[model samples]
Target: MALGLKIVLTFCLSFSTLFPKPIVCLDPGHGTKNARHGCVDEAKVVLAVALELKEQLKQNGFEVVLTHNRLGQDLKAKNPDQDNQKRAQIANRAKAFLFLRIHTDSPSGVSAIYYPQTHPNRPLAQESQKAACLIWRQIKTVLPKTLPQGGVLPESRTKIGAQNGDLLVGSKYSRVPVVTIELVPMSKIGRDWIFQKKNQRLLAQKITQGICDYLYSQH
Candidate 1:
């Protein structure tokens, strides 16, 4: 490399390392490998929301990363457990402000937000709940009118985490605050206005509002 080029490259790397940008890692729930057939799958809808969220977050001045960057990501996958762990690892590697997973199918028939019941690091657990509450409030505003409101909850209290004593695989492996937002029951998802472009945009904006609140309030 030319002398001047090397100097510029070195300075850029140092700047990135010394004053790292705040990153938010988004996992767009399950993908094709686990997708439900004949319905608008959770993977497809969540990816759309995440893509919209990524743009909104960037406009608010935060760097964004995705665990499943695209729909094709799960095409060759065989192990769901390994996939979930890798999703958490992506957030850890990014050193994100938080790890937020987006999903549309909620068997519970309510809009719910879940945080780790007992993260190994006490502060992480607290931060996770705080963020979940902030996001949950915003999410409620955009939910279907008929959908019941499920308050921010500890993972252990929910049936979704039954396999792991109330802890989801992603939260179990995460090094930072992890939150999973389940939008609505899959049944409502198909008939509702959720997939409408206008509705999706509004939902993205509300979610962005919550994330910004949690991330910037501290500073």
Candidate 2:
């Protein structure tokens, strides 16, 4: 009887360990007035992507949180990384498995940001870097190849490029693997092509696929 009980307990523990709770924090960068590009605000584009990503993740059995949803009360914060503290608090409490900051790029095109391996606050785990690379590669594979502007980005030499230096906060305070994806140029194409409703929806779908591939591959 004792032996049977031990075996059953061990089996249950293994099952639980193999299927740990998964949570994701999605942040939409920038706000309305001071967007990276004037055509479509970074806030608007990112929020669109975040909502779609949230839906996709939910379907895949993951809990999702958005740093700035439409119903959010306040968009203004004096802190450099405005919502970094709040994001970190939520992720820590939920024990998030991944943190993704989403934004639409300037007329420059698609790029993803990861904390350099040397960054002081970067998680010391090799697995986190591996996860970042996986997501980066997946996004690179799916974005429109016809556009010369989009591709995986080399790490920034200085953190300042991540927007007023506060950009580093995503990777810095992240307890789990973190990545920020700047998707496509807001103005490179013609006005009709650039702001077409269909194009934005397609972009969101591709991003959701990238995130799903990354997480599923690890399992």
lDDT by residue (tens digit), candidate 1, 1-219: 346334433443344456766799998888746432323567777888899989877765678998877776663445776677878988999999899988764544567889997878889999999999988877787677777767798988765577786788889999999999877766654336667877778878778777766764565
> Candidate 1: where is the Cα deviation over 4 Å?
1-19, 32-40, 74-78, 189-191
Q: Quote the RMSD, in angstroms, for model 1.
A: 8.6
Candidate 2 residue 33 Cα shift, in angstroms, is: 11
Q: TM-score of each candidate?
A: 0.83, 0.70
What lDDT would each prediction earn against the true structure? Answer: 0.76, 0.56
Can you give the lDDT of residue 186 in candidate 2?
Answer: 62
- Model 2's alpha-carbon lDDT is 0.56
> Model 2 compared with the native: what TM-score?
0.70
- What is the Å distance of residue 189 in model 1 from its true position? 6.2
